[model samples]
Target: MKNLIAATYAPMHTDGSLNTDKIKDYSQFLTKNNVSGVFMNGSTGDFTSLTIDERKAITLAWSENKSKDLYLIDHVGDPSLKVAKELAQYASDKVDAIAAIAPFYFRLNSIDKLIDYCKEIAICAPNLPFYYYHIPVLSGAQLNMASFLEQAKDNIPNLAGIKFTNNDLIDYGHCKSKANSKYNILFGYDELFINSLPLGATGWVGSTYNHLAPLYYKIKELFENGNMEAAADLQSKAIKFVELLNSKGGFNGVGKGFMRVLGVDCGPSRFPHTTLSDSDYIEIKEALDGIGLKSWFSK
Candidate 1:
């Protein structure tokens, strides 16, 4: 299987309900822009705010509109094993692969515990290719390369690969070095695509791709075509934009702002993440205008 360059996040209405139409529109938007895949309802997608049914609806919407040329990776992470399994089953026929984070909100003290969690999910959907979503900062599960291999190498047969989100290049390199050729290691940071690819990261997953697919695909194209300098330059520009967004706030606010600017009708994030301030909007607009990306917002 080819390594997938993917984006993760959920699309919600102003009322905090899953916006099925917007989800379909976003999926079509990504496919049109040549994104290899899209992962729905992950951490970036605001999984914590969505009910299991809502998550399934978003997945189904994506599956319905995604072209034959594109792939879909559903993020089915839930604190409840039963809910996670139910979502996995619901997405089985809808996505190319299924991924889930280790049950978060509770500390998984040992690697074995994490492995067991994966195994249970794998059993739930035996035919699906299961990818491990590793974002320790949010999951409260600390998994190094050694512990991962030791625990999962034998038991989780359907373990296709990992979505490594931590900013540790050393750990990423270690995982790449240890991973068999069959396993895919996708980078989770949008800003580190340049460095991550050269270090054997085969794919990427990030929040920004929802608004900037063209730039991301261009960077990937440059790297795959052996033009490191050009790729680095593009990555630098992308990093600047990411820094601008982070400066405004974190992903929830900035990402919502981006969708609004793009006219995608994604609406605001749920409570705990309010609408962007006037200053924040100006900052985002100025940055986009400076980068000649104002067209993305133009109706």
Candidate 2:
């Protein structure tokens, strides 16, 4: 739960089947860019569209290419608790850590229910650190995260921290102060990385980090050097990167294609997420250049 962790894309074949062969190169690419960790089988990965077996395959591929410098965090969340537990068990031995988003379909309205759900999955991977992926937008469980940490601390033994994707800075502050700043609250909102620094965010997990690691590292450096204005400007540029890609169909699909521009060749995204043609990528890159983001692209 330190430094930038890319919520990785699940590489696919043209037929929309899992192309795990690309993962070795994907891992190498992230490491080359100095992205310290990978959060696979999560939203950026289109986990909801993939089968349990497919999700497991993604984890295995990453595990095989695992490096000391690049740690792996497999997101084992599923609407089905059984499936989540199964994925957790499968990932337990393979990854450095594991995370689970709340059951998105049914939705856990109460904190206790969420803790119970996490508790079950945590026990499956008792040895590995557990992270609760608190992305309320997609999960639909907008319960207070601070309250969750207060309650879950005692019940869940392996509870390391939360991937706080929500934008509620007040609640994020409360979560950071909880247990005397004990839990590793890895901020998940890419656009708000600078904002989180004031609240003491040492770790981050985001899709944008996949493309702009150096930019973010620079942002952090500027902020630490007491250059708030420059940090804000760079953060604005990073946000523009997201907005630019999102303008082309949707960011999820378009962003995956941008990976190819970085030389990973993750192939195309699945249905509902618009897959861009080669010409479309050219247009997208041109658009990025127009916004002055070409220099920030992950190396």
Reference-based TM-score of each model: 0.89, 0.98
lDDT of each: 0.76, 0.92
User: lDDT, candidate 2, residue 121?
Assistant: 97
Off by over 4 Å in 2: 179-181
Task: State the lDDT of candidate 2 residue by residue for 1-299, as single tens digits.
Answer: 58999999999999989999998888888899999999999999999989888998999999999999898999999999999999999998899999999998899999999999999999999999999999999999999999999898889998999999999999999999994757899999999999999998999999989999999999999999999999999999888888888998899999999988888889889988989999989988898888778898897
lDDT of 1 by residue, 1-299 (tens): 34445555567666667678777666666666666778778876778887777787888888888778777788987888888888888888888888989878777878888888888887777888899899898888887854696579899998888888888899888888877676787888888877887787767887777777777667778899999888887777777777777776676667765776665767767656556865777777887688755543223
Give the candidate number with the greatest TM-score. 2
What's the CA RMSD for each of the models? 2.6, 0.9
TM-score of 1: 0.89
> Clashing pairs in model 2?
none
Model 1 stretches with alpha carbons more than 4 Å out: 1-4, 224-230, 277-283, 291-299
Measured by lDDT, the strongest candidate is: 2
